[model samples]
Target chain A: MQKHRGIRSTGIPENILGYLMVAPALLCILLIAIYPVFRTFSLSLTDMKMQFPNMAKYIGLDNYISLLQNDRFWSATYNTLFFTVVSVALELVIGFVMALIMNMPFKGRGLVRAAVLVPWAVPTTISATMWKFMYHDQFGVINDILFRMGFIDQYQSWLGSTSSALWCAIIADVWKTAPFMGLLLLAGLQTIPAELYEAATVDGASKVKQFFRVTLPLVMPTMLVALIFRTLDAFRVFDLIFVLTGGGPGNSTETLSMYAYTTLFRNLNFGMGSAIAVLIFIFIFLISLVYIHLLSRQND
Target chain B: MHKSRWSNIIFYVGVVIFIAIIVFPFYWLIITSFKPPEQLWDIPPTWWPSRFYLGSYIAAFTERPFLTYLKNSIIVATSTTAFAVFVTSFAGYALARLHFKGKNAILALALSVSMFPGIAIVSPLFLMMKEWNLLNSYIGLILTYTTITIPLSMWNLTTFFRTIPADLEEAAKVDGASPFYTFIRIILPLAAPGIFTTAILVFIAAWNEFLFALTFNTEDALRTVPVGIAMFPGQYTLPWGDISAASVVVVLPLIIMVLLFQQRIVSGLTAGAVKG
Candidate 1:
């Protein structure tokens, strides 16, 4: 309703007025969010370790080159991608089913919906630690349940080994984040008109047929958007892995973000750390571009 | 009718499974928090604690300055929420109501910034904070948290403000009310639900934030809940019981908030997510 007229009574231009309204926020964001990013790029090229403190010299492309050849960096990248792909895939299927169930005409649906959000609302650090307790080899309930269900022969350390540690972290991530995907997809489901379903029923389509023909087609865009969002979040995951395994069992669950954190803080290698950080930023930027490209193609 | 009945059964089964997956972890968190240290390492984990033990909770309070952690968490979360909401309201209002140049660009930039890896900037931001004498302080953590939360809140509040009816603002303006007056009195009151939703979301994020809290706050007195719990040291052993109790303390407020405001949280989440 507040249209941008050419000029106000005091002769202030409309564009300037709009800019003034948004300036404070934009300034905060630029100062806090955007500027540090550029600074990170500058730090990546220099050998700046916290321990050294005095000598700060730019050795251009050396950080990036060394990082590219580093086995630990490559391994961390693999772990990150593997975790993101697997967790996002699981969350997609599980979340879609959850969304469909939420859309159904059922008693206590509101209660069920609220119940589902418990996982998403719980902090990642807490959930990761909670899962760490649950995965304890000696006393974990997971091993107990699995042994009872004849899934595992004996109690095993879920986070103690390199192979199983990443999977364990993945499982925790899936549990925590699937509800977020479900919430997003449920929003998409709510937009569809009931008349479409009625029409499908009148045409003698089965429920499965209706889902494939109507629901899937209609909700696919939303599903992809959710996928992209989850992918980005998963790729940069640090808290879950940090708390669950500390990227341990020999860096089995190490992600790029974890790698960056370790180098920046633990090792105090700011030069290499910033390089990893910039690579992460570029990876996310590229992934988002691909997703947006797909989105635009869909619009056409 | 038979087909409908079968489908109903299937629906109920799905609901059961979904609820089970979501609720099981929290149930374990609660049970673990209450379990005695001995029971915690039992051969087969006890599903229920032995007679509702309160030792862990007491330890959570006494052993290490956990109450300090709680106090700091509350301060940081509340401050970050208040600051983020206050700052984003203007930008959100402009994006939603005022037509301006570079609006879409600003929105896109904000969205991109949302994806900016917080880890990437931590080095510089850390150095900057140290230079500013803000490292290990509430203001440092709050300001950093604001940067992360602002983008998400901006997108959410912008979408939310756009949903309010335009006619009300038009009527207020027709009554010769100043733009600021109308925004403060008419528009803001109307956007209460959106603002509340955004505030809760930001609060939860700041409360849960670990890296910034852990990196910035080295002093035990200033540490927030997540960092405190993560860095919680034990004298004799790993202190699983105390850690569990601390986890519960960190998450219980969030669980309560989520359950109480499920509808608004869901809507807020969906609104930001749907357009993506």
Candidate 2:
């Protein structure tokens, strides 16, 4: 099943047939992915703004240079990287633990798996809003629970302060996305054979030892895949941050995407926004290259 | 045996906490939607609503164009699903069945495309849409959604199509069936389950899409449920009740679907992830 079953052709060669079949989708991808990227690159080189679309001039790398010197841009870069690193690291740990538990033989395993996916299934904005409600200073559920247990003297406004706003955003993000990591890792877990564990057990290996030696090696590729997906997604965090804090209290939670969005839409600064957009793409590209390098090396 | 019993108890406890972390927000959202305004801000909170209140849901419909938003979301999402299915099916089949010159190249290209930061294209897409007079149009949004979904759906479908044994298609070929005829009659029917699963996946993705929907369709009449909810007007102060009600309306169906099709979604999502 690694290769698709090829049929015996009578008239047309397989190459031509393949081209004909793939043409529509390839065209759509070109229009959808490649064209916009090329367009963005061109747009980045100009002084384009929505209000004065006709007054645009070719500004060679000015937007990029200016963005480099801007403190706000640096903060967004730092914030995005921070969110990506912290949330992804936490998600990997939590998701791995959840995956291990889900892989355990038990009653109601199916139900439990479904329960774990609920958070991922909910829309991001909705999840953010749900957390916002729970983090409400005056009547939030989290505040109520913490206060009742004597953990706090009184309720606190979680999203209103600069210090805690980004972290709160991260917590909400981790809650919504950790299940996605769990699901991907669980898929990896299921693919490892039970016989490996049996063999380890026959050799008198402890469960912990077997996990390190047998399970980890077998599932590393799938884990890498999950890591790459989650990292890329975390780097582009938008809806949750927007709905939760709106880059808030004072630019603390402003991700690259949020900054680009505000520049493009709110400020109507298309040229600078495209430059930020390009920078974000370069960051993603570099990150993917690093992971793919790990991927290729793993093949050895 | 005694140790195993202790491990089992620990495992169940772990599962309970996992479920709690994931599901509590949804529970809170539902409760908040039904709580009367007075109980909403109660210190220590009324753990449960005294009565199920429909006031917020009523307000959601009356004060905002909530129902219209639902209609708009359905239109764009369904259209995107249909377009995705039509294109990805043929592309998946080609990648799976026929030996092509750039087969590996196309697969790798699709994988890289999946990693693209969508916001990178937002500015360009906005300008392009405006130039084409497509801003605020459903067709414009549908086109964008279709592009966003193509890479993953194609990868998923290609994986799925590979699972169909070659012998069945060869048998159809032996019966003098044209290749197109064989695909139409044999492969398409067998691929129904995969197509349905992919369609559901794409539909959900498009439904939850916020960035494009927010920017492209700025008109009040064309807003999707998510943007509609996020951009719902607040007067004087924040409208928590109405917002919660809209969140419930948007999320409840997805939660129900995930529960009903848990196995399908989990497998489809994992397949898309690992293979991509």
Candidate 3:
């Protein structure tokens, strides 16, 4: 194997063969994923509108300049950031607890795990719809349960109120994703050797102490990765919020992606929409950078 | 002993609560799908449906053109899975087994592409599809879906392909078998489980995809499940019953897949994260 590692018997050098093999997949990604990003960036630079394609001209960041002054854009940014932080935080805590439980040697663990994945398996849009129904003010199950339990005198408008709309979306998101987060954390938990716990126990470390000292530190990498995955996902959230609230009750639930969608498709202001798209990309890129840095630092 | 017993009781309670929270929404969805419209909007919503009413399911198909949506979803998801798996298998093989410069760079690029927001590119893709007259077509959605699906498939297959020992290929080479021949005959068979897992994950992603489907396809016949359910008529008065029925139809297959291959899905999903 070492002898033939440098060059294959077929005389197509390994490096050249590698390029040949990856070409098709690379082409697809470049054209579809990479090229469109560049196109969006370039489009953001021009004053393009779907309504007047012939009148399109170079605008040189005017869209972005105006976007900086746009109150709606700022609100959307705040909403996206708020959603990403709160949902990811809740998911992490809930998912960590769920992971610890699933990691236990319990009967019916398989069944429980499968049940937990039910939310993850459901489509996001469906989840949004289901939660929307549950959060309905008058006839919603949430209201019924709360009212029946004497938690509230009357059913409250969850999605209809600006104060609660984003929270409702957040709750729905955490419900759909906490299981997935738990699954990821469970994988990390499994990677910890059994002997580590045994040794900690021998040292007379209590459960809480051992968790803080051993499991928490060891699972940090997985947690960070899962965090970034959910963070970016939450930042780009569209379908759930779109379906659930439509960014309603005075645009309280509007996200950057929703703003971009409304601009590009609904208003047909291609230039402004492209600018929002570019901004979304930049924000996501910064997030990836920070996490990658943290990840690498952790590894070292 | 008393303390441990109390802890055990608490643990069981925790487990029960966890299961209930995760499973209740799904149970409600199924229950609502069977309830009559009046029951659906009752002052105190019925905990359980009085009878199995098939009206919602009947309406979902008969009234909303759900069959066409299901058909389109299947075609787009299946094509995306096949094309992504086929293309990425070779890339994965090369990354895993072959000596190559720029392999890490390519992997990084793929990873970043996976993170790229679908919303960011939807407009340009819409325009591109328009120019090619590919909008509202299966091919357009499939091609776009591949871009999102390929990265994960590549990473997963690469990770899986690396688990396979090179000795099999070495022996094949000693027998004068070509590299391509070894990959096709030996590596692929050994990597079948990994490939299958990747295929399932890709299919689910493509199946659940909403943004591109919403943007590129306006025609009802071309709408995927997510889009169809999202764009359901009766905007003023939402059709919770029909929507729930459609959601059940769409989610049932996914539930079955997760139940049957829970282990494989876990491994595939965590491949990049845990390993990296």
Candidate 4:
């Protein structure tokens, strides 16, 4: 399955031509990806504001030190981690179940499959705004329904209280994204041969036993891939929090990305913001490195 | 024992609730959008429209540059998608199929950039725009957005390219056609579906992109729909009717696009999610 890429062709002229043809792509990455990243590293040193003298004094490590001590930084980190872990755990379990349901031979499967994607298809900001309305204190639909059902007598401001804000945001995210997880898991599920399930059933393997022995092992790698993608996405979350609570009823829902954005543009403290950015970058890089090692091991 | 009837009943109950969680918000938005101004705060809000009115939509545009903003969003989204799909395809094909040296390294680097957090570099990016005199320009917004989405588009496009058999390209090469010629005439025709898929995916991403739209565009005129619509209820006394109307207009086009390309979108989700 591995396509070896150690220079297969012999002719020098055509090889050079091939290289020329691919220059635009290399240019895009150089101009877009590599350049912005370098700029990010550079901008971290500046105490730039929104106004003139965009470059501030290069207070090298002071910004980094200040961020390390900031109380808000610790709180944001906890919220980010909480948001990432709980939503992902919930998504994985529910998504796994949804994927399993879709995998079954059911009537109206095609219609149901498309219906599952309604949330994922909607734009993030749009969906967040919509959910915020539903979470509105006075007349939001969620409060109304819960009130009628005797779940909570007082109107639950889902995005207002510190206790509930982050989870409320995650509920919106999970609603919007779980279908995506289901779709991905379903794809992974399809690749699994039905014959494997057949072989297990014939071997007198209990359904639960078969799942543990056969399904879990085969799907773990794919599931982990999904896990890493979702985890990284959850870690850098911004737009939803911004729209839902504007980082809160007093910074209750403020995420690291929102914090970084606030420090950079809103507050115009590029040095501190960039330091925060750098921290996030390092954290993400370390996480990916671990996952890459795990993934490659599985590949081997 | 096989699954009990009670378990099946419970599963259906769970399924109905899950479907409600997904559907109600949008349904409420649609219903709210159609209601008249007096009904905005009606007690015990109706699930369906009380009466259809076009006034909110009219008010939405009258209050702001709805058409211009929509056009600007279309221009930015369309151009970014076109550039991304065009550039990434050539590169993706080369990386996926060409037996070039250091392809692995290039692929790895590309993948790494894809994972780079958007928030990590957006500030620096803002500074870059200011330096370049790109303040409130469509081109600037497009350029920055193109960067944010390149990794995603490239990965998907490359994978789509990789799925194509090399012999297809080679067959034309063997027939005395040049590689570029074969690519344009032979490979591209067959890759039309992939191309379409990439464009739609990239377009939706760029269209839905709020960070750059919010960060890069300071002028009211330069704003895209997401940033534009976010500003609808901006002032203290926001006209609720207009906000709902604008929301409907902004989101409807996207929903329509998805429905039109329903097949491709589904497959795209499958590839993106399943392959991870």
TM-score for each predicted model, relative to the true structure: 0.95, 0.96, 0.97, 0.93
Per-residue alpha-carbon lDDT of candidate 3 for residues A1-300, written as tens digits (9 for 90 to 100)? 543443444488778989999999999999999999999998999889998877889989899999999999999999999999999999999999999999999878999888877788777888888888889888789998888899999889999999999999999999999999999999999999999999999999999999999999999999999999999999999999889998888999999999999999999999899999999999999999999999999999
- Candidate 4 collision pairs: none
| lDDT agreement with native, every candidate | 0.86, 0.88, 0.91, 0.78
Share of native C-alpha contacts between chains A and B (below 8 angstroms) recovered by candidate 1: 0.68
B-chain TM-scores per prediction: 0.92, 0.95, 0.98, 0.91
Quote the positional error of residue B138 for candidate 1 in Å.
Answer: 0.4
lDDT of 1 by residue, B41-89 (tens): 7888889988788899998899779999989999999999998999888
Per-residue lDDT tens digits for candidate 2, residues B193-236, read 99988998999989999999999999999999888887774756
Give model 1's TM-score versus the native structure.
0.95
Task: Estimate, for each residue in A1-300, the C-alpha lDDT of model 2 and write its tens digit.
Answer: 211233333456667878988888888788878899998998999999899998989999999999999999999999999999999999999999888888888898889888878888777888888888799888789988889899999889889988889889889888988888988999988888889899899999998999899989888999998999899999999999888888988898999999999999999999899999999999999999999899889889
State each candidate's clash count.
0, 0, 0, 0
Best-to-worst order by TM-score is 3, 2, 1, 4
Worst 10 residues of 2 chain B by lDDT: B173-182
Chain A TM per prediction:
0.94, 0.94, 0.95, 0.92
What is the full ranking by lDDT, best candidate first?
A: 3, 2, 1, 4
In terms of lDDT, the best-performing candidate is 3
The DockQ for candidate 2, computed on C-alphas, is 0.60
